[model samples]
Each structure stands twice: as C-alpha cells, then as structure tokens.
Target: MNAIIDKLKMLKYVEVTASWLFANAKGRDAKTFVKSPQFASYPEPTIQITSPDCGASPATLSPEYMAGGDGRLPGLEWESVPGVKQWLLICEDVDAPLPNPICHGLYLGISKDKLSVTNSDFKPENEKSTRLNGGFYYGTNRLWIPPRPLLNHGIHRYFFDIIALSEPLDEKLAASKPTREQLAKEIDGKILGWGRWIGQCERVWK
Candidate 1:
C-alpha cells in the first residue's frame, strides 16, 4: 500500500507540471511582453516617479511589495510638467495567465498640488485622508494589488505608470469608477506628461 501511494504522488507531480506548461506555452513570457511593440506606441510623458524607498529600476522586488507579502506600498514621489492640472496613477501586471494583462491599480483624480503618495495612503481605513490629498477620487488600486505570478509563468513585470492631464477631470467623471478603456477616452488628447517605473516579481509555486 505504501509503494502504491508513492507512485500516485509521482503521477500527481507530473500532472501538475503538464498543466503549467500548457498554460504558458503561448509565449506569454515576460521577456516578450516587455519588448512588445504595443508598449512603444503608448504615450510617454516627461514626468518622473521615484521612491526614497527604492533605487531606480531595480530588477528584483522585495517581498513587502508583492502579493502574499506585507503589502506595504512603497512611498512614491513625482514631478509635474507645465500646463498639468491633474494626474493618473496605475499599476499593471503584463504577464497574467489570461486573455489580457491584469490591471492592478487605476487611481484617478489626483490633484496637481499633490506630488507624492505614502504607505499610509493605501490603507482602506484612511479613505478620508486619501481623498483629501492627491484625490478627488482614488479609483482602483485603492488596495496594493501585488504580483502573484505563477512560478512556471516565469518572471512577471509590473509597471507603475503616472500620467499628467491638462485639466481636472469633470465632477461626474470623478464620481464614476473608470476602467482602462473608459479612462483612455478622456486621456487621448489631453495628456501632457507621463512617468513610469517597472518592477519584476516571480513566485516559487511548483
């Protein structure tokens, strides 16, 4: 009976491996996504985002910023360009196991007077304070949506994007939750500057 149990365990391992391979066979790997031309066509503004907490373009991510980690959003500082009235902040995982990349965070209605976000700004209990700062609305990414990419999927890249808009979003627009598609409608001709930072996270699932 013990020998039979061991054989079953081995078979289970093989099945898991096969499932992972099938899920990732389409070359949805991070390397290809980072280099994909679709990225090039997107608007890139001259603004910049940084963290007193992190170095510029560090390849590896700390567990504190990843899914299943402590989930403390690293504090961020950014610059604004001339003619900007507001900004949008977003974080996206380009290598999820799905038809499209997952949108982790989509924060809108950030005011021009604001230039930074702290770890506490992400706490759900602090809505009053968040709305008072860079926010007329703190859309999606209200929570720090960490990367939990499957190990077999290889390393995943999460992009933190900031876009400067020429004017404050309309009150009606601020009240509604906007998806990436909806946000694009307002941004198409109005963006003045863009800032971005990328981090890589990989899990050890097997």
Candidate 2:
C-alpha cells in the first residue's frame, strides 16, 4: 500500500499540478488543535524532547524515515520529569492535506523510567523490540506510518508530542485502542507536563 503511494508521489509533474489546483484546501495545525483541550500552553517546568536522528527541533527529517525510504520511526529522547507514572506519545503531521492533523504514531503505556527509544526499536509487530515489549500499546493508527507528502505540496511539519501523565491511562481506554483525538480528550487535565519536538519533510522532484 505504501509502496503504491510512494510510486504515485514520484510522479512529480502530476503531483505538483494537482497540489497547485487544490492550493486553497486547508489542513489543521497541531498548535491550534492542542488549544482545544487547553493543553495549548505547557505548564511550568516543561520537559524538552529531542531526536538524535532528526537533529534539533524544526529540523528536516531524512528520506529514510519517510515512505520513500525505510519508514523507520525517528529515535527520540527527553528529560525525565518527576511524578510522571506513565506517558503518551503522539507523532502527527500538522501540514497534511486534511481537515485534522494526521496521526503518524500514537503510543501509550510508556513507563516514566524509560527515557528514550531508538529508531531500531520500532519495527513490524511480529518483530518486537525491548521498548515495545515494555507493555506499550499502539493507538488507532496502530504503528508508525511514514510521512509521504505529495510533490510540491510544500513542506510538512511533523510534531512529536509526548505528554507526561501523573497516572496511567484507564485500562479500558487503553484496551480500546483509541484514535489520537480520543486519547487527547481522555488525557485532558491529567497532564503533568508535556514536550514536543518538530521535524519537517517535503516531497519535491525537480
């Protein structure tokens, strides 16, 4: 499925022209979406998230992480915040040509004791890694879906937002395998703190 999408994306002329035709269409931004839950502003003493593979915030993600390449999830690390018992991590494309921000990955049950996850750790469900073996479960999207923006669709921003929770999510809720929207609503004021790292990507063939 992804291979087909990648192939279509390579049709640079078709993609660029189609994208230009729908230039007025809009996509949701993560910044604005976060405001709905009033999680808009980070609370005092926020954690700083960074990706060694993707470099610093607002950095450009390599093709290997996109559908055109290996589609591996970027490795990420962050400072541990006190009193966080569990964590929720969401990777989203704020510039996707959709009404809502597209969720690339949603994970729950991240133990606070774990500070980082390497790219190799995220693999096919059949081939599990230690990080995933730590009782973590994927959300609606299930696993990482590599970003594959259309050619000339302009640059797309991926926001890796991790929320520190004072307690673990409800067992029933976790079992439901909720979507990003559902998970965000469930977390609400339960947030202890949060951090975000941004990586940008674009499909351009010239």
TM-scores, each model vs. reference: 0.74, 0.82
List the candidate 2 regions with Cα displacement exceeding 4 Å. Answer: 1-13, 24-27, 30-33, 38-45, 124-131
User: What is the C-alpha lDDT profile of model 1 across 123-165, one tens digit per residue?
Assistant: 5445443353334555542445767766555677777777778
Clashing pairs in 1: 45-194
* Model 1: how far residue 123 lies from native, Å: 2.4
The alpha-carbon root-mean-square deviation between model 1 and the true structure, to one decimal in Å, is: 5.7
Model 2 TM-score is 0.82
> What value does the lDDT take at residue 37 in candidate 2?
60
- Give the number of the best model, judged by lDDT: 2
Residue 38 CA error for candidate 2 (Å)?
4.9
